[model samples]
Target: MAGTYHKDESNTVNRYKHQATYDVDTIHAIVNSTPVLHVSFVPDTSVPVPVVLPMIGQIGHYPSDSESHCYLHGYVSSRLMNLAASPPGIPLCVAATKVDGFVLTLTPNTHNYNYRSAILHGHGTVVSSDEEKLWAMQLVTNSVVPERYENSRVPPDNAEMQSTQILKMRIESASGKVREGVPEDERKDMKRDDVLDSVWTGVIPVYEKLGEPVGGPYNRVKEVPEHVRRFVDGENARRWTYAVEASRKPAPVKRVKKQNQVE
Candidate 1:
């Protein structure tokens, strides 16, 4: 057991405790699986509302370390990026969610969705060093479409780099919650023969299916790029399989053995 991440008061999961996981690997996977992350921050205390924005980002770690940091890129003059770049940086919360299936039950009260979600609390600090900024920018670009950075162009030109700013967020705490398997009905509902006969109860598997690529009119490439083609096919297949299995079977609950007191 690599030590578990500390659960701070704010991140402690209060509902469905069994669905909560503080494991770093589980939390990272959930964050990476979602395409876009929603970032929320209060620009100023005087302002009544917080601002939320959809952003593209990725999680990565240093070669010698297990801890991870999130990298995000935006226009140099954007409001959010400017605020994050200010001294001490701005406090932000990042959230990502992926819905696997819609659990339909005989009773309205028992209905719920099978999904995976993660929340990360961090301070958004700008990446200043040129080398690190380039690396982080490349990471974010590739995240949108794998291998896209290399396939399209080499290192970005000076103007492009100058216009873009990258933020390296230091994660303070994180939590992940996942729900899977078929609908769970109450004993009373299951025992009622009439209810069972009249209502259809099961999971309606849901997945984000990628469509075929349609290139632009000016596109010179004769065929769709191999990397792009593979990504679409691969993602669709993975989601389809996960949805099918989760619809029928229960997720396996893992039990960990306790370490010996004297070990």
Candidate 2:
């Protein structure tokens, strides 16, 4: 809320200037709350093609570091690890989006989504420090489900530690856009007698709802663990409440597009 990311050409929002935010806290919140993040990078492959990988990541503030960086992990990406370990690290882009509701308008072109999105640009380096890596591993684990790391197997053993690699992407800039509220249409459409009578307009709430826990085959515990149950219940309630509330907010002011701008 207090510290904001400096806006620059790379992170500036030209189109919905009103919804764009460079707030550090807001960007972190959007990323942390989203279940998955898409990280894109270029690899030195024979063909040299861009790769977009879905990863589990969270922004963390370590006591040793002056600024926060996103810790990344996924099904072992050895190539990315190698790139990160190289001098100066590898350039990376991380994006996350959470859909709150679907805005239905009189016409299809006016339909839109209520959402929060963030884009981060940075260079990622492999976290070589064992202490920091361990801490980051725990941080990512808990991000998925609170207290999951501590509840699971204690400090990772030699094999686990050796096999896992975590990346610290020192964020250079971040930009976020948030869209909420109900349906909005042009004045012409709003005043149309025939069109207005024929069409339905409103917002349909959307959210990621966690279902009842199903125990694994090897799970001998009779009842669901307190942590697991708590996370399921808590996430469902929070996500649903936000979605419904967003659907009820006042619609965003419809702006007239410039003659040169395309819809």
Candidate 3:
């Protein structure tokens, strides 16, 4: 939920103490907005580095009975040696994309998606705490399957934690950009028969769906656990309903009214 940091008039980077906005709502929206995040980092040394890495981690609450908050954890490189080149305080950029609608225009270049996306640039430090690392692993599980921790077995010891490396990024600058509506060329292109017919055009919506849960291998009881049943009926249902409602809501109107007009 880090707020967008504006450059000072003098053009120097501000410290973390400056008045900044990191609203919970903004952070939640950014976390759920996209399922995939593209993470990029620079090696501390002058050697050339790869520009992109695909990160698949859940950003959600811890498993224990507590208020849910956002936590991000995932393995960067499988090879332990790759971690050496990464600096302690260097900034890493994480970006997410949520395609809400499509923009079909008269020209091919104008085609785009109506999306809500977030780009966060910040420095991440390698986690060395035993307790924090265990909590991070639990957070990852809960992110993927809400309330899965309660139904599953707890992580026993530090050996598992030691195997995984966690990084906590202090989010410095974040920006959210969104676009939604019918195509910009809807009015003009509708009038042109050739332009309209040449392209098969319309909006194709995307959504996440939860299928029926399978029983765990170790479960003695044959029936699905109550937690699994409740999750399917509760959170998953609500999310889909909310997404549909958001899609149906009319885009904000920006018409201007004449001054002193009462009509």
Question: Could you say which candidate leads in TM-score?
Answer: 2
Most lDDT-accurate candidate: 2
Indicate the worst ten consecutive residues by lDDT in candidate 3.
Answer: 11-20
Task: Show where candidate 2 strays beyond 4 Å.
Answer: 45-48, 254-263
For candidate 2, the TM-score is 0.93
Model 1 misses residue 258 by how many Å?
21
Q: What is the per-residue lDDT of model 3 for residues 70-109, given as tens digits with 9 covering 90 to 100?
A: 3446565644225533655455777777665555566776
Q: lDDT score of model 1?
A: 0.81
Per model, how many backbone clashes are there?
0, 0, 0
lDDT of 2 by residue, 22-69 (tens): 999999999999889999999875666888989999999988888889
User: What's model 3's TM-score?
Assistant: 0.69
Candidate 2, position 141, lDDT = 95
- TM-score, candidate number 1: 0.89
lDDT of 3: 0.58
- lDDT (Cα atoms) of all candidates against the true structure: 0.81, 0.90, 0.58
The deviation in Å at residue 50 for candidate 3 is 3.4
| TM-score comparison, 1 vs 3, better candidate | 1
> Which is the winner by lDDT between candidate 1 and candidate 2?
2
